[model samples]
Target: MFQQFSLTHVQFMLTGLGWTIGLAMIALIGGSIAGSAIALMRVSVNPVISRLAQFYIFVVQGTPLLVTLFIAYFGATYLGISVQPIVAIAVAFSFYAAAFLGDIWRGAIQSVPKGQREGAHALGLGRADTLIHIIVPQAVRIAIPPTVGFFVQLIKNTSLASVVGIVELTRTAQIVSNATFKPLEVYMTAAAFYFLVCFPLTLVSRGLEKRLKS
Candidate 1:
């Protein structure tokens, strides 16, 4: 028997929406921490450290995120290690996000004018001091636009968590659609939820870009 899409179904999806937001937050925080290390390593004076960071980025970027998620979730069982779904999703998304964030940050750091570094050197500031005080402040301005853009993308990508049994928004929509036999109504609601989350971030990104430019 087909049931009508009702308020109860919307409430169920709201629960999923919360999980989606939670997952994206986990990915963002984890990714930012790891990505900071990777960015610093990429800019290291040591050739080996820089090359290693480059290699890590290369490998992660080359692999599809779905594959990475599968490896983090399902592959653990094959190796006799138990992994929770949320834990696996966090780890996979973090690792995937780190590669791209690292590169974005690296470009931002490098985009700092050469003359600024020279000026810092003239003032006898060491590399570390110059980076912390002079370079990083400027780099942050450059990084913000892209970083927020990626975060919006990350929020949408959390839908993929459904593959690993995550009851995030998309998964909830699936369940509701199955129960109600109203795929169109269920999925459209899910899309609206996504847009509501993402559109504000898009506006903020644009606002930041304009502010930085001014």
Candidate 2:
């Protein structure tokens, strides 16, 4: 039995889209902070600190985002700890984003010309000032395209948060589909919304890349 899709259904889906954006923002902010630390630590003079950051990146990047969310949401039962599903989803996605962002940025930072770094030190700037003043500004431009790309990925991955009961876009579509028995229409509509959100970012990423090239 199928019911016709209505304007209300469209509005319902729109609300879900809001949640998707919110989740993506959470992932972006949390991931950036953690990623910055990891990237800096990876370049540390101390071998031990560098190795530990490397290990963190390896394990995180190696694991699937869904599995990480599962552990964050469900693994807590093993220790009798309980957390809200949204909290778990946010934490998982953030850490997942962090690993990839860290790698992206580490490459960007290392890509800065060696002479530039030496020049900073030669001017009597300490390592920290050299990096903050000279290194990161250059690295950030290199980082933008990839960072935007990862944010797009993060937006799509928020669908997984629905599995943990976070009522985001995909979850909303599932509900709408069930109510109207029009899974195809509802899902296609959901896909359209996703494209709507992501296509602009893709264009922006391209524009930024071109700008950087010039």
Cα lDDT of model 2 by residue, 1-214, tens digit: 7668888999999999999999999999999999999999899999998999899999998888888998999877677978777887888888888888998999999999999999999999999999999999999999999899889999998999988889999999998999999898899999999999999999998888899879
Query: Cα RMSD (Å) per model?
Result: 0.9, 1.2
Reference-based TM-score of each model: 0.97, 0.96
Clashes of 1: 0
Tens digit per residue, CA lDDT, model 1, 4-88: 9999999999999999999999998999999999999999999999999999999999998888998899887899988787998
User: What TM-score would you give candidate 2 relative to the actual structure?
Assistant: 0.96
Quote the lDDT for 95 in model 1.
90
Candidate 1 — which pairs collide? Answer: none
Instruction: Report every candidate's CA lDDT.
Output: 0.95, 0.92
